[model samples]
Target: MDIIQDLEKRGLIQQTTDEEGLKNHLRNNQVTLYCGFDPTADSLHIGHLVPLIMLKRFQKAGHKPIALVGGGTGMIGDPSGRSTERSLNTTEVVKGYSEALRRQFNKILEVEENENSVVVRNNYEWLGQMTVIDFLRDAGKHFGINYMLAKESVSARIENGISFTEFSYMILQSLDFMKLYEEEDCTLQIGGSDQWGNITAGMELIRRSRENQDEDIKVYGLTVPLITKADGTKFGKTAGGAIWLDPEKTTPYEFYQFWINTDDRDVIKFIKYFTFLDENEIAELEEEVEKRPENRTAQKRLAEEMTKMVHDEQALEQAQKISRALFSGSLKQLSGSDIGQGFKDVPTYETAKEEIGLVDLLVNAKISSSKRQAREDIKNGAIYINGEREQEINYTIGADDRIEDRFTIIRRGKKKYFLIDFQ
Candidate 1:
């Protein structure tokens, strides 16, 4: 199947303008399509995955994919899919964010020296150079108050007090589409479902701007459904915060675990959504999910693919190793850095390096309520230091017990783990 049909089968399309015409356009020539991503934060989250993947899909399908970083529009935050107005960031912050997003997109999309590689453009290049009079005369003249009000973004925020800055975001995005269309011959724009308004506004801009000219301008807009979970909980959110693409923000282990722990009901859908595995391979995994749900074969593949794609192979290997060691209750093979990366979120405490008995050490680390409970836990074989079962309360934690003399892992039971950092 073609990339367009494949995306539809995966349930990626939510709305599109001129679908048949766009299909024919793709069939005839290598269409240039763009999707704008506002750098609202320093790093893109899991919510941005579909659009990013869509760009890759198009590039692999012998088309030019332009990733528009909204350096200009991001200054005045997008009001789409928001219940309230956004807290605008400074120009400096937005610049930093834009650069950060650019680096990330460089990794995700194959935008290197290849001819069909993706192109990264910042709208601020054109928008920043234009004067207010030029903007009002060229772009603003095309948008009427009634037409702008009708857009879903403006309509929803109209009652809740929308600002002119955000209300004008649609026009800025529309200008982006028009600029790309004029300069790069980019004829298509893709975004999330909420972007239907801005995207159509762009298509309209392209059409109206070229009306007086003899050139035939045909542009299209396509939107993908908002990423959501089957259980109705918000996707890409955890107790800590958003799952950041930056490994420093969210470790590869944590990122892998997020997909690995996908619900049984949602795993199949996510495999189709996230993985490049063909239908036969996915179908076989689906069968595994049915026959051996306990094995979590589908979830494992999903995690592996996602981790390796987002991070490097070395990072994926470390993540898998960490997960395996944790599952098997063995940290002896893992280094200090590996242990720290894997257990970054686990309960941690610090203590001066000294000769300490197992019972006293447990009390010091707060892994036990008191010396009495620590004694009971040790005698009952629940105390484990660096993967070694310490049944005797007299067991002393020495320099040898520490993992590379930096950290020590203490397991109170089969699952309860605590990291004691040595000073």
Candidate 2:
């Protein structure tokens, strides 16, 4: 199947300027397409994965893909999906964010020297150099006030009021599309559903700039659908916060858990939207979901594919080990690193590396209300040390209880866990 058909099967295509023309464009030539990512944060979250993955899909189809980092526009910010004007970042901050995003894109898209390898470009290279007079005369002249106001991005913000800086962002983005088309021979731009107005504006600028030429301009735009959950809540979010792509922001283990906890109602659609699994494989997974929901086979496979893709094989293996150890309550075999990732969010207490009575240690660590409570808890077998039942209130927690001589696992009651850090 063609790239468009594959995207269609995944329910990825939300809007396209000219579907037939784009299909022919891909069929006849190795189309060079581009997708822009704004550096609103230091790291791109799971929210940005659809477009990044779409770029990969194009590259796999023998088409050249360009990952455009919005170094220039990011300083100004886009008003497409916001009710309030964005606070502009300083030049240095935007540059830092731009560089960070460039590195991430390289890793995810696999930058290499080849005919259709992903090319990373920063828009600041051109937009930063263009003077205001030149920008107004060249790109801004094509975009009339009425045309700009009619766009949903601009119209929706009129009631709430938008700054001139953000109001002019569409023109800046159009300049990117025009510049890429003139320099890189790029004929397609793709983004999420919110970017449709901006994408088409770029196409308009390209056509209007070359209106006198007796040639048909073939610039086109496509957008992926906004991901929604079956339960009416947002996707890629939990009570903690947004699911970041950077392992430091959200560890591989945490990332794996996020996918593994995919709601049963949304699991199948998520598998299609996120994973590159073939139709046959996906169909089989669907069968597994229907026949054996208790096994959670589909959820596990989704987590594995996503973890390995974003992190690596080792990271996936570590995440799986942590998951198994947590599920089975057999954490004694876990290394210090495994325990760190698995129990990252649990309560922790740091103390000197010395042997202490179990009741006293519990009271000092605030695990128990007082020495009497600690003794009662130990006597009732409600406290466990290193995953083993420790009912002896006088038991000494020493070198033997520490994992790697750095950390100790303390469990109180059924699921309440605490970490003891030995300094």
On lDDT, the candidate that comes out on top is 2
lDDT of 2 by residue, 105-152 (tens): 998898989999999999999999999899989988898999999999
TM-score, each model? Answer: 0.98, 0.98
**What lDDT would each prediction earn against the true structure?**
0.90, 0.93
Model 1 segments more than 4 A misplaced: none
RMSD of each: 1.1, 1.0
The digit string of per-residue lDDT tens for model 1 on 24-106 reads 88888898999999999999998998899989888888899999999999988899999798998999999999999999999
**What are the runs in model 2 whose C-alpha is more than 4 Å off?**
none
Q: Alpha-carbon error at 354 in model 1, in Å?
A: 2.3
Which residue window of length 10 is worst by lDDT in model 1?
108-117
